[model samples]
Target: MALFNKMLASIGIGTAKVDTRLDSDRYLPGQTVQGKVEIRGGSVEQKIEEIYLTLHTTYIKEQDDKKYTQTAALEKLRLNDPFTIAPGELRTMPFSLVLPNDTPLTYGRTKVWISTGLEIKNAVDPSDEDFIQILPGPIVHAALLALTDLGFKLRQAECEAVSYKLNHHRPFIQEFEFIPVTGPYHGKLDELEISFLSVSEERAEILLEVDRKAKGLAGLFAEAMEMDETMVRAFITKQDIPQMREKLNQIISRYI
Candidate 1:
């Protein structure tokens, strides 16, 4: 017996059945995810008006200085224009969906949920929700590793809305903060902020901001620095612990 049969048996629905199959268990951003939806008529003939799939994501939003949990439809697809299923008949439909390049990377594993359903008139709805684990790409991993190698320890991470007019592009931005491991720079630098703008599998833009401590003397203020993608990648590939310390010293020396 098929898995759909087991599901239908549990639901006690003798009129309809639904099943979904994903092409792969893992995917990167900007990649195509393909899948198929299979529907089988139960013990009796059924009118399958339409089938649809919805991609859903759970995120947090802020309003009135308060945060709220919410879910949004990332993508949607209509599979059929209205069809009928005879008794014991099987029907299948294929679908292809593209994931956004700027999708936030989850810590361990996050679920990409796809809901498949059939809309029928004057009857209970039949649907299935499948979860797929999303993995981080190479660029993301490399950038994080570089930060750790620079004697920075992870503090906290959050996602905030950014404007495209500002050239941020994506609807959200992931912010990570790190503190200097140990050195005279510990008290001199408040923290380092990093954000990743992944454009593709191999290309990612990193934004770095340094929060410098203010001096007590006159004409002293905090300074900020920003590095582009090339500089960041080069730093990742070329710098060791001593070299990174020297680079930081150079940056601080310029301000003094």
Candidate 2:
């Protein structure tokens, strides 16, 4: 009976299971995420080599005219060391993960989650996934609010794959898409896309892609040729929040 139990455990029939519970389901970028991992032993005893938590999100990638959603790991945390668990044992370990300052906000199709797993040799690893909401930091939040106040409405937000030359740490960047529905540039521009190049407590570096509205035959031709769009970079600081509207207006007016 003991040999049979060991065989079952080897095939994961009596392996350990992992579950993670977060203190909160929502967080801001750069915030410290606190949580605890729960481990429940299965029908038999098992050895856990390590416990790891990985932060993951999905991005859209285009290959040969086909679009694919790929999962990317932004960060990984290795928890407890090797330990042994007897039959039907229960263990809880507390952990904390500091979210990256550039973590994308949970908007539109963008989603973030934490995956907890146990490393067991010669056995199926038990894992769990928990979704979480990532809110924009203060600087990014101010920028979005400023755009809204300027009469722009958010249309969509997504993460798209980029060249390694552009971003080395991650293969994709999150973009916030907005349309000038009733603003001063309503008739002059079709849409505006914003991407955070980097952000910090004091300032945020952003990339703006402004798509000009096509006008007559010439405009239509230019649009078809993909020449109606212009990309510009801007830096916004906490001090600029009060004047963000005017500042953005000035920058966009030049292109329009």
lDDT by residue (tens digit), candidate 2, 83-136:
988888999999999999888899999999999999988789889999999998
Q: Model 1: which residue pairs collide? A: none
Q: Candidate 2: lDDT of 223?
A: 99
Model 2, which residues run further than 4 Å from truth?
164-168
TM, every model: 0.65, 0.96
TM for candidate 1 is 0.65
Candidate 1 Cα deviation (angstroms), residue 51: 2.4
State candidate 2's TM-score. 0.96
Off by over 4 Å in 1: 1-15, 42-44, 108-111, 155-158, 161-171, 177-179, 182-191, 206-256
Report the CA-based lDDT of candidate 2 relative to the real structure.
0.90
Model number with the top TM-score: 2
CA lDDT, every model vs. true structure = 0.64, 0.90
- Cα-lDDT of candidate 1: 0.64
